[model samples]
Target: MYKLKTKETDNSVIEFIESVDSPKKREDAYQLLDIFTETTGYKAKMWGPSIIGFGAYHYKYDSGHEGDAPLVGFSPRKAKISLYFATGDTERENLLKDFGKHTTGKACVYINKVADIHTDVLQALINQSIRFLKETYPNH
Candidate 1:
């Protein structure tokens, strides 16, 4: 059974964000956390060392590789933040068209700052990404 992950004293994720040494980045981290929760309807939790993750899902590919992963997450990189979605495609081209100049790597979307992109569009992308994953791997 899944249980809510309550606050912890040793939250490496929060600590990492606080250690960024940049007020803008720190503020961005909090904004991302709020946006992620509001968009996904899933509470956020720290995953591993420096990821803010929302919800969870189990996956089993046809190749037999399988594991559980946070339904959605992001890492506050030094130069930019990376949002992790399950996939990417031309379908999101319209949104990306005005994503304020960013790069995409496989399943991750890299952005310099939250202000650089449209918040509503970002939320839309996150929501769409989650829905895609759930539909693609319903068992998860």
Candidate 2:
């Protein structure tokens, strides 16, 4: 099995984010770093190259694939900022409806730009996501 190299080391992660060309994107990433740290009560760490991750959780599925991952975090990708929340089964659709302006994947919420969304809604989403992660992955 091969693990994704997106997150390989902390220094690499910092370097990746710091190297982003846009000041606005860098500032947005910093803002998210602050929020994820505060909300998750976990010191921000580079998950690999670009992910600013929070708490760690161990997960095992019925098929037996298991690994550890951050309880919640985000990656400022080239196209959008990917906010990671572990909820995938009907946990935040209501909030998603009014998430200002964004898109979603199975476990990620994507924002084209921080300014494109409402900060208040984003805060609520992050708060809700953190609570859900803590409840779902208590030991992590």
Candidate 3:
């Protein structure tokens, strides 16, 4: 069986943010904490060592792999802040078109700073991710 490395922990989100090496990134992390909390209406939790996540859902794949994951999350990394959102939502792509300066991978949107992107679009992404997860994993 495969193990999920990014499981949620009892670790403190504020302590993690305070440990960020860059002062600017630390400040951006705090701002994001507020945004995600207000938008999701859930308190942030630590996912693994770095990710600050809000809300959660359990997913079981067709191959029988199952795990719990945050509905939306972010990590203030060394190069850029990686924003996590639903992986397969078409609406996510449409919103990203107007999301300002950012780059996307399979599950993360990387941005240089909070000021570089629109918070309204960020909130929309967070909400859409939560809705998609709830619909996809109704039992969770």
What is the lDDT of every predicted structure here?
Answer: 0.77, 0.75, 0.95
lDDT of 3 by residue, 13-55 (tens): 9999999999999999999999999999999999999999998
lDDT of 1 by residue, 1-140 (tens): 44433222236666777887779988999899889989898877777666788877877768676667787888887888988777644557667777675898877889889888888888877877788778777885
Model 2 agreement with the true structure over 31-134: per-residue lDDT tens digits: 88776777767887777667777777766767776667777788988888999876763647877777778888877889977778776666677777767766
Lowest summed lDDT window (length 10), candidate 2: 4-13
Cα shift from native, residue 60, model 1 (Å): 1.3
lDDT of 1 at 131: 83
With a 3 Å backbone cut-off (N, CA, C), the pairs that clash in candidate 1 are: none
Looking at model 1, residue 34 earns an lDDT score of 89
TM values, all candidates: 0.83, 0.83, 0.98
Point to the candidate with the largest lDDT.
Answer: 3
Question: Is 1 or 3 the stronger prediction by lDDT?
Answer: 3
Off by over 4 Å in 1: 1-13, 88-90
Q: Give the runs in model 3 whose Cα sits over 4 Å from its true position.
A: none
The residue ranges of model 2 lying beyond 4 angstroms of the native Cα positions read 2-8, 12-14
Give the Cα error of residue 140 in candidate 2, in Å.
2.7
